[model samples]
Target: MPLFGQAAVDQLLEVLDLEQVDAAAFVGESPQTGAQRVFGGQVAGQALVAAGRTVERDRFVHSLHGYFVRPGDPTEPIRFQVETIRDGRSFSVRRSTAQQHGKTIFFMSASFQVREEGLDHHSPAPLDDVPGPDDVPTMLDWVQRYPSRAGIFASAPQAVDVRYVGVPGWVPPGDRVASEEQRVWMRINGTLPDDPLIHACALTYASDLSLLDSVLSVHGEVWGPGGVIGASLDHALWLHRPFRADEWFLYDCTSPSASGSRGLAMGRMFTRDGRHIASAGQEGLLRRIGERKQ
Candidate 1:
């Protein structure tokens, strides 16, 4: 298999690095992919970056909740506005908002905390139960095998290595559906800086990529054409343990319910050695059109 190359990875990092126009205000630009709307992950990550920039270096983000207020325009620059909520001795809270053309596109409230010893008991990940990342096929490989099924994942320069445990929702009705149980092994395609905030921000970006896929899998649905169409409405994340985004981690996701044209999915992140690191959840607007869905 060919390598994804560091070029794409570098591009991701650059995107995360925002320009500080003023205190508590930052400007960010999107990749010129020429997509219809800005990716939800990019805006979320950028909002986090803006919030992280205003806080002291000692504190690290532990949790974040964000809402996609409006669709973003990729061709325009996003302005991030951050407000200091509170900064206690052990904890700090910040609110970050992303605006395009003076209108809010995304908003996030993040909490940061200092390291403190605490009781820890987390269930081990099923590493032995599933195949290692090396044993699975890459997104490029999946696209190669199912060109008809590959939607936007068809190109190269993949920044993150996403290896699905089984067939993804994008695949037509298959032997197994990930919606019942969606797990993917992923990591940055290249090494990242040693900054904890950067790692957290990068993972924040990756977290949004597939959380919604589980909802699609619930009905064995695919994207585009006759499949179900959806848009993420909100996202939430919590970091329980430290982790490096450049290393391999497993995202085990599942959908609790799908009603009123809305679907909810939750996921947990675990290190390869089975340490539970983080948890992520999202809800989206899903609508089925055409005869393929029925």
Candidate 2:
């Protein structure tokens, strides 16, 4: 079933609340891959939620670092183990490992801090002139244009509303341009509860969506012949400020390097008003494939 919209988001929140552990143990056995692969964003968001639960309510997650060890099995339940790494006066740290079928699939370290006064400084916000997610075409509308490739969009949990600033090139390849950056507008598809943790986790999930493609764009390889075998290997994020997830935010991504069959991309997320809320960085394996072998 399509995992997006209100139903899916509500179900995910239910699971999150009912299985309220210091860590998350989710089972996502892919009916397609037949492998129990944990979704990287899910693990990351769940880990952040776990860490947030342990800290004071006012203390929000400020940064997180995670590694993808092995492809997770979606069919089997994932066990999340959380370690309280540090609890200082202003900062707290926690480490979490997501395991499935007796094997580690994801590991993450997160830091939380009580909101405090600091010299606020950030790079000039990008895409302040772009329209919000509402003004752009919904992802579902785009998916209908290519029913055959709908699986990719359908498989994703649709808690988020993603609108590409430009036409998506997943099928019938769009204009291939060589640039080091890409832009997309995103926001929660439904009203999120007031819990700050939920907002943080939601942001965690949204951050992983399309940042890596910025790297591929630089080589004119995005949606290349047979497309690129792109997979995120590691993801890191630094939250600079707090904001509502349901509000429209622009994700401006840039690629600084691509070598050794790996590409590094960084993103800065900003509210429509030009407030820099968070920054994300990721490195992924981008191997060009000759044909659809998977």
Candidate 3:
């Protein structure tokens, strides 16, 4: 087992660098992120890495769809088995499944395509006069303000710098419920090498952090003693342009609907300067536990 020291970015890069165990199978270990279960984004990103390793360099990944079958054990290593579904003249498709203890935990289907020019357009990024990442409070600040949750917040993965654009669910202000939308500015905490695949994978890992929370914002729910219970069920991503993970990007997230014990969230990634870079969507199990509100 490899330890990722104190740097979150280093740990992420290490985990993404999988060890080839067979022609189409690879093994990856979890980082010491202090969570009971493995992060869903980590598995998705790593699975994409496994598939990308088997792909030709000329083709870059454009989209991926994945499902979370079961919670992953952080103490155990995950094995990724990739299957080549097709390889066309300009596109390739691959399916990757992640397993632990001989049981499937996560699976993904990814598509890659060669560079080509086409009509290009995107939704305009938000124009709110939001504070920059530096001006916003860090997780450490939250831990200090809310000492009861210090251990949990302090132990979270520190690979990315996250600055919430609004008050987080755990920290409410004067009973004012959060708006339907949630925004955060995030990027790799430290500098990363110039590898496009590594950048893409790192962004994928960061994308999952606050998506579901957007749904909670709508219902004035928080993750406290009697908060809501939620877990991601499935996720998908579409890359629109090339970008670096080390630079600041605003993750604008919102929930469109919640029903049948599930919630759907959609997000768009934009550079600080307003370049729409990517889009992500996820559906998660969102159940209200404990006593219902009267």
Candidate 4:
């Protein structure tokens, strides 16, 4: 049985829990949030779930690479077709394709592996000089301090709680303060099932939350009016260690470059105790709405 906390998390769990339609296929539905488009992370997580179901339980996901082909209409249910790419002695690879309106919207290739002894080393945790979750302000605190900055995100708390270490991406361009990086402490905001696959999928969903914010932070730009709007083009992740989604983890991200209206962001997640767990990279289209296109 899964531990429980927020109703929002329960809803998120429901969204991640797909309906099996065939031997290697599943159907995922969107919550009626009246949003115009499906969240890229949501589709990616569901696709991971679909792929996970077809693989051996002992094998945990080690890496995934995904490309967002099209925007999905939130009003429609998505169908996932999982293909068994390869199942080697200690590794398994699967490809998941998400389709809506009979058209492919997103697809991912994920590889899983069984436990094995291996030499290991990772970069040191990046938050040694940063404040802990207790010191960082929550969304409510932010709203009270900078209500104007919370334009598109001035809603109720989400299943996943995110606390930025500094100015968030919602800060407009005119008021922007460029930063070298974006740091955040986040978690599911509730208890989750103990399944490793579930935790991995949850992390997959949460990884997309503020990655692009790093790109925005680079130039002190925000999202929305007077700022820039964007969409994720691709997301990739590599998990090096096991972690629980319900536990607070630090996500440290930065943007190395931007050109031709595209920005690339890279990030890593470390446990509160300072174990480096995963690394994520994404490239997205970041275009200013007021700017004219050729």
Clashes of each: 0, 14, 0, 0
Candidate 2 ranges beyond 4 A from true positions:
1-4, 18-36, 223-225, 291-294
Q: In model 1, what is the error at residue 163, expressed in angstroms? A: 0.5
The parts of candidate 1 lying over 4 Å away from their true place are 1-3, 173-179, 290-294
Q: Which prediction has the highest lDDT against the true structure?
A: 4
Give the TM-score of each candidate.
0.94, 0.88, 0.93, 0.95
Query: Please, what are the lDDT tens digits per residue for candidate 1 over residues 1-294?
Result: 233647888888888999999999999998876468988988999999999999899999999999999999989999999999999999999999999988999999999999999898998787788898999888877888878877567643478889998776677545444448788999998989899999999899999988988988777777666677888999999999889999999999999999988899999999988999999999998887653442
Tens digit of lDDT per residue, candidate 2, span 82-175?
7888889999898877777788888899998888996978888866466667777788887887666555675666777889876554644455
Model 2: worst 10 consecutive residues (lDDT sum): 26-35
RMSD list, candidates in order = 2.5, 3.2, 3.0, 2.7
Clashing pairs in 4: none
Candidate closest to the true structure, highest TM-score: 4
lDDT, candidate 4, equals 0.90
lDDT of 3 by residue, 87-146 (tens): 999999999999999999999999999999999988888846778888888866776777
Model 4 scores worst on lDDT over the 10 consecutive residues at 148-157
Candidate 3 Cα errors over 4 Å, as ranges: 1-6, 172-176, 291-294
* Model 3 C-alpha lDDT versus the unseen true structure: 0.85
